[model samples]
Target: MTSRTLLRLAMAGAVVAGSLTALSVPAQAGNAPKTVPVRLLALNDFHGNLEPPTGSSGRMVDENGNTVNAGGAVYVAAHMKALRDANTIEVAQGDLIGASPLISAAFHDEPSVDFLGKIGVQVSAVGNHEFDEGYAELRRIMFGGCHPVDGCSPAGPWKGAKYDYVGANVLFKNPGEKTDVTQSLSANPQVKTLLSDWGVPALPPVSIKWMNGVPIGFIGLVTQTTPNIVTAEGIKDLKFVDEVKAANVASKILKLFGVRAQVVLVHEGDQVTPNQSPDACSAIPGAGNRIATQVDPEIDMVLSGHSHQAYLCRVKDPAGQDRLYSQGGSFGRVITQVDMQVDTKTRDIVRSSVVADNHVVTRDVDPDSDTVTFMDFWRDKISAVANKPVGRISADITNVGTATGESPLGDLIADGQLAATKTGGNAQIALMNPGGVRAPLTYLTSPASEGDGVVTYGEAFTVQPFNNLMQAVTLTGAQLKTLLEQQFPGGPNNQPFAKILQPSANLSYTYSRSAAWGSKISNIKIDGVPVTDTQSIRVAANNFLVGGGDAFAAFKEGTDVWSGPLDIDAFVAYLGQNNPIAPPATTRITAVD
Candidate 1:
C-alpha cells in the first residue's frame, strides 16, 4: 500500500477504536483517538495603544484586589508570545484602531494595524470606530494603500493590515437610490463600485482557519445601533443588520463548508457587575447577553467587544448546551485565553472541554524587543507633532461626569465649539456630546517634560480625537427644548440612557430626574434670557450631533446648517486663545430630585 493510504487506514482505525470505547467496548492499547488542542488569545478595544496607556485606562484590578498598571503593545506582544504554541491563534473582537492615541491616530492608525499584524492577529471584527473614517478608509486599511489625503506621511508606501477584518452585519445600502460617496473617497472609483454591489456585505462575514487538519470558522458582527453612534456621513451607503441573524447565517455557511467548530467575534458587549473579578460572569443587562443566548447552536464560542468591559461567561445556547462568551477589557488591559479540544473525526469542538480565563496584561514582564523597536520608530516619527505645546491648563479638566451628567472637559469643548462658530456661523450657543470628550487634560507635565500646565498637541488631540467638523444650525426655541428632552431615556427619541449634553456657558437648563421623559426638561435659557418657543436660535455643535448621532434626533431638525473648522482645530485654537484655561464648572445641567 502507498504511504498515504497506510496513514489514512491508521487514522480510521483510531476513530473506530475510540467509537468502540464509547460503546463500552475495550479499545486496543495505544489505539485511542486523539483530539487536537487549540489555544486562542483574544483582545478587544485596543484603540491603538502602542505605548502603555495613562491614568485609569492603563490600570486593572487583579484577583488580589490590587490595582496594577497594565497594557502596552510591547507587553501584549510578550504575553501573547509566551502563551502561544503551534496550535494557537490570536484574534481581536474590534475597536482595534479608531479613537486611538495621538501617536497612532496621527498616522491614520497605520501603526496600530501594523502592530496587530506583526503580533499575528489572524482575524478581527469591525468595530463601529472602524467606520470613523468611513468604509472607503477601512477598505484601504484592509487591502493596503497610501492615504488618499495624507499620502503616507512618516512612512512611505504603506502596506495594509496583515489580518482579515470581518463584519457580517455591515452590508451595502440598496443602490436603487444613488448614494454620495464621502469626499475623501471620491477619487477612488473602486470604492464607489463596491458600494453599488447591493445585498453584499461591506466586509467578509466569516474567516476560516485550519489547525491540526481541523477547520475552525469565525463569524464577525458589529452592533446594529452603529448608525446612531457613528458619524452619519461616513456610513451613508451601509447598514448594519441584526447580529443574531447574521451570526446564524454565517454559521450555516460555515457548516456547508464542512466546518463544525464555529466562533463569533462580535463588536457588541455587556458589562459585568462592578468590582467583580476579571473572570466573573455576573453580567449586567446588554445586547451581548441576548446575542449569546440566541446564536446558532453549532457556534461554540462568542468573543465580544465595543462596551470595553472584561468578563468571562458561559451562557446556555438554545440547545441547553453551555458555550464560552467573553470580552477582554479595552486598551489592552486584559487578554482572554480560551483553550478547547476539537474532535478530529467530527471536526467539532468538545464544548465541555473548553476552559477560558482573563489575564491582566501587567507590566511586570519584560517587553517584547521587536514591538519596542516598532514603537520607538513611530514615537520618533510623531514626536515633533505630538510634543508641540498647544495650550496650558491650570488644573485637570476630566471627562468624568457629575450627578447631572455634565463633565468639565465637555463644557470646555462646547465653549470652544461656540467660540469657533460664533463669528462665522452667527451662532449663539454650543452643545457638546459627553461621549466626544475622550480623555482628561491634566496640568502635570508628561513623560516628555513639556512643563507643568503646558498641554501638548498630542494631549489635546487625545481629548478630542474624532476630528468631527464644527457646525452651526438654526433651531427654534421649541426644537431646542425638544433636543434637551431627548437626553433622557423614554423620551421621544427613545435613547437607551441619559446623555446630558455639555452646554456652553451661555446656555443653562434644569431637568427633573423623577419627572416624565418629555416633561423632565424645563427652565431653559440662553445668555441669561429665558428662551421663548417661537424664538429662532443659532446653535453650534459638531457634525455628529447635528447629524442626529447618539440618539439626539432633535438636532436633525435644525435649518440653515453652516459647517466650520474641524473640532480638533477649534479646540486647539480655543486653548491657545485661553492660555492656562481653567476647568469649566459642571453646573450647566442642573438635576432636581
Candidate 2:
C-alpha cells in the first residue's frame, strides 16, 4: 500500500477504537507459558543543569517527607548505570534542554544533550520548552551541526542528541491553506528528517524502539496548551493536538504492527500535594490525571513531565484497568523505575504485575567519574567568565516560593527589572513571573563556593537564564487588575495552578482564595496609592510576559511599549549597584485565605 493509503487506514483504525469499551482481561490462561521481565528507567525536565542545583530546586522530599539534596548529572549517571541490566531501557519524559543554566545555555545545551547520550537515554518526549528557540534550533539540537547563528562552540561543531525525540500529537499547520494535511506533519523539516531517519510513520507512529528482542512502541505527546505558553512565532506553523486523542490513535497504530507493549512519554502532568512524599499521589485531579483516564488501554505505561512533580500512580484507563502513570521530578532530581512482565505468546503486558518507584538522586552515592570528567571539561571552558564576582549578598535569597507564589529571589528579580526600565522607560512598577526565577541566589552553595556573601555572574545567569529582554509597557489600572486575576487558576486560559507573579517594591495587592474568580483580587495599590480604573501606569516585565506568555493575555493588550536591557544583564547590573543585597520581605502579595 502507498503511504497515503496506509495513513488513511491508520486514521480509520483510530476512529473505530477511539471509544473502546472493554479493557477487562481473562484470568491467566493456562499459567502463561512464557514471560519476560523488562526494566524501564525514566527522568524528566533536566533543563541542561549539568551541575547540582541549589536551595529548594535541588532538594526533593523523600518517602518520609524529609527534604534532602538530590541532583547533578554525575549522580544521575551513577544511578542509571547502577540500575541498568541486560533488559533495561532508559528514557525521559522531556524538557531535557531548553531554559537551561549558564553552563549549558552558553553552548546552547549541547553538553547536556551529550551527557544524556552517554548516560543512555534511548528516547525522550518533545516538551513545550523544546520549541522556545523555534523549530530550526530544535533541528540543530537533534541533528548535530554548528549553530546557524553563533557558529561552533569551543567543543567544535555540535554532534547532536543521541536519543530520538518523538511527538505523536505535534503536526504541521499551514496558514490559510486547506488540505488533507491537518494530520500530515511530513511538510515540517524536522518531521521530514525524523521520517527519513525512521520510516513507516504510522505503524507505531514516530518510531518503535526495541529492547532485547522485545519491541516497546513509544508515542510522545505534549500538552495541547503548548501554543499559549510558547512564543507565537516559534510555533505558528505547528499544531499541538489533544494528548488523549493522540495517545489513543498511536496506541491503535502500534498494535497493528504487533507491538503490544506501549509506553507514552507525555510532556504534561499533575501537581501533587505540597510537601508530601515524592511517591504520594494524594487524590490528584489535574491535566495529567485527565489525560491518563482517557487514553486507550493498549498503552501499558505512561511517563509524563512539564508539571515537574514526581508521582507514581495507577489511574484507570478507558477499560477501567489500572495502568502505570509516572513522572520523575525535574532537573534530574528524581528517577523512576518501572518493571513490567510481558507474556511471550500474547506479546502483551501482564498489567497486574507492573510496578513503579521514584528514587531521589541522593548525593550520598559517589559521582560517576566519566560524567564528572565531561562536566569538568565544560566547566573549565566557561570558568573565567562564569566565576567573575558580580556583587555581594547579606544572606541567602532563595526561590522557595510561598503558598501565594511570592519568593525573596523573585522579588529581587522584579526589583532588578524595575531599576532597569526606570531611567529609559520611566517604569513605575515591575512584575516577575515565578517560573522565570529558575534557581536561588544561594550564599554559600557547593560546587561553586565564592564565599558566604559573594555572588558570581554564573549564579545570576543561572537564576535568569532565559535571556529575555526587558520591556516597559503602558497598562490601564483596569488592565493591570485583569493581569493580576490571570495569575490565579480557572481563567480563560486553563493554567493548572495559580502562578502568583512577583511584584516590585511599589506594587502591592491583596487577594483572597475564598472569593469568586473575577473578584479574587482587591486592595491594589501602586506605592501606597490606590490605583484607579482610568489611571495609566508604566509596568516592567520580560518580553515573554508582555507578549502574553504563561497565559497572561492582558499583557498583550498593553500600549506604547518601550524595550530595555536583557534580563540577565539588568539583574547583574542591579546586583553590582546593590552590594550586600538582603532578602526582600514577602509582604507585597498578601493572602487572605
Tens-place lDDT digits, model 2, residues 287-386: 8888888888888878899988988888898898999888888999999998888776666888998988899999999999999899889999999889
Predicted model with the maximum lDDT:
1
Q: Show pairs that collide, candidate 2.
A: none
> What's the true lDDT of residue 322 in model 2?
92
Give the top-scoring candidate (TM-score).
Answer: 1
* Model 1 misplacement above 4 A: 1-32, 175-198
Please give each candidate's TM-score.
0.90, 0.88
Q: State the lDDT at 422 in candidate 2.
A: 98
Over 547-578, each residue of candidate 1 has an lDDT whose tens digit, in order, gives 99999999899999999999999999999999
Query: Cα lDDT of all candidates, in order?
Result: 0.84, 0.81
